[model samples]
Target: MAFPGERSQPRGTILIANPSADLYGSDRMALEAARGLVSLGWRVVVTCSVDGPLVPQLRAAGAEVVILDVPVVRKSMLSARGMLSLGRDVLTQLPRMRRLIKDEQPDVVLANTVTLPFWTLAARSCREAVVVYVHEAEAALSGLARTLLTAPLRLANGVIFNSETSRRVSGWPGLERRDRARVVPNGVGGPPETLAARERLDDMFHIVYVGRLSPRKGVDLVVRAAALLRDAGIEPHVELVGSVFPGYEWYEAELRELVDELGLAGHVRFAGFREVVWEEFAAADVAVVPSRLDESFGNVVIEALLSERPVVVADHTGLAEAASGFAAAVLVPPDDAEALALGLSRVHEEWTDYRRAARSDAPRARRLYGPESFHARLSQALAEQAFPVPSPSMKDASWSPREVLD
Candidate 1:
């Protein structure tokens, strides 16, 4: 709600910082966030795990890039290897981030994603300007992630969330000194050409799900739904995208087996990760987000809307909130294979008009999710000016109180 015409005064030189690289969806979002901040005339500096698909892209976005050789690893649930692996790797990387922190001395250090709350700790000397952008779970927040991310998040000034759901899940709504939290949903802005060319894919129907094959992400649920579709005699050609995050190969094995067991071998294909998915969108008709738990927001759903592809999304978390009244997207409960199949079938049955309406309304949604709003909001975070308390000027101008607090 604080985006678009929420209309607050703005500033510049805000630091848009986060954990390194774009190998993951949230990481890719980090780069896009940096580009957006720069577009709004702010001095943006990105510090991520030094190696990944996004380092060069961040450099090209006119932001100062510092590589923190943080061994950023993803942990799997119901296991010990993932926990120990993440703890050891992140603990080792902690000191490396210290050197970068002292050197940058940025106005505000925006820690993109929950995984790198350590950046918040590093920015303590900078203070107030350390905005921790919480999109995904870190090692220290809840469940197992909380145990790992414990140390770094201690020094964060404000927490900027990608969705209200993520903020609530993280339990950092608004505390004290470092309790400032703002929910500025991630924006959608790729090449306009990607969107314009989507009309040519008018004939084919796509049931696209883009994300790593992880237990938490619930990629296997989609595979199961594919099987359910097969049982019903609907041959839904599923384009499974993204690879497994490191140390989570078992999740991949499970998904692969489910796909095989359901007799959907030819119907379902693992497409891995694609640099740009405009062509993939062209080949498909609808976007499917079937995450089982804790998705802050579904960027693919927004991107699908941009490409004018109708979305059938999991109805929990921010995805449900985002899909509210959107003409092109349909919402179904998470983990409900029956509902997933029903939604998918309904979308392909009547796709054209929804696609056109989606394209028409996408710009409005894009504006809500784009850089200008993000910059102004993030600038405020760096400035530590979120929810400004009224001063003498306000007392002099107005004399009425809306309500009494306690």
Candidate 2:
């Protein structure tokens, strides 16, 4: 069945460009979207700025992986030097990308992140239709960076937001154009039924936080919350199952210091990056996402719910939307250690009830975010033509580095 805002199109070749080669939430969504397209008999090619862990996963999903040196303009790009560097990189790569697009001659080009809108702009000069998969909430973008990023979105034929939060945050040029932009929430596979039988361990309650260890992710807050729990006579074992990205070791060090200062070093375990964190979810009685920034979509929350584990999320931004679907989720104020501690205690005190609620609600949560539904919505976006796909123009003028830098 077609969703509210989609129309089916005949299958054809499509090129999907993502910013990174890592298998994070956005990367996984791109890969899954490629898989979904392939299932519909569409030939797919994927491109990334560099080669990393997710290349093999993309290949396994039957999509060709192309490594291109595309500059991903981050929030840091709002500065003069950063903008100059970004402009130079875009200018340097434009000709090569244009040639690549000409050679591939895809029917559609899917740019997979807000950081890489240059891909969509590149496709604007090609015969291909450009569709942007916005995985970020534009509220997180700096003013100048937001303007720069939103400029290219004006040229997109379609825009797919990972959540309503993203849609509202990103003031895309064509946001009011109903057929052009719509929301398609991220999807995840169902957990094994045996996960529902996870009883609280008598020795220690297992609390898990599975995401990047970064300042914005509030990993330090999770550690502080653990200390608060100890103060309340609850000695739960908090397992942090992720690591900070390279170049952010200082943040990781800070988190460690916070744990040490609280005298909860023995209570918290840092499990460095694991390719699959589902096992970590399965082992935990409670899952926590203490994010300081607005999350576009909370994949960890859904995973924990599917695993029949109660979730505790910061009560702000898209996190509330994510955890709101499940009754077992506990919401606490962002960055408040005492509140988080109380939340943890509440979950532990009502363990039996929360576990039962999670188990009972697991099927509904799984169905709401199942792969089939996501693919269905994605297919509709890919097939729909909100605006006419521009014909390839031989006289298309490339943007000057000066024009971009200015």
lDDT of 2 by residue, 274-302 (tens): 87877888788899999998888888888
User: Once superposed on the true structure, which residue ranges of model 1 sit more than 4 Å away at CA?
Assistant: 1-17, 71-96, 125-128, 137-154, 172-179, 194-205, 231-233, 385-406
Task: State residue 305's C-alpha deviation in candidate 1, in Å.
Answer: 0.9
Candidate 2's error at 289, in angstroms? 0.6
Residue 266 Cα positional deviation in candidate 1, in Å, after optimal superposition? 2.6
Cα lDDT of model 1 by residue, 107-206, tens digit: 4567676665546655564343566777853323355556454335445656667777676666442343355667777766644564442443333344
**Total colliding residue pairs, candidate 2:** 0
Residue 4, model 2: lDDT of: 20
lDDT of 2 at 72: 88
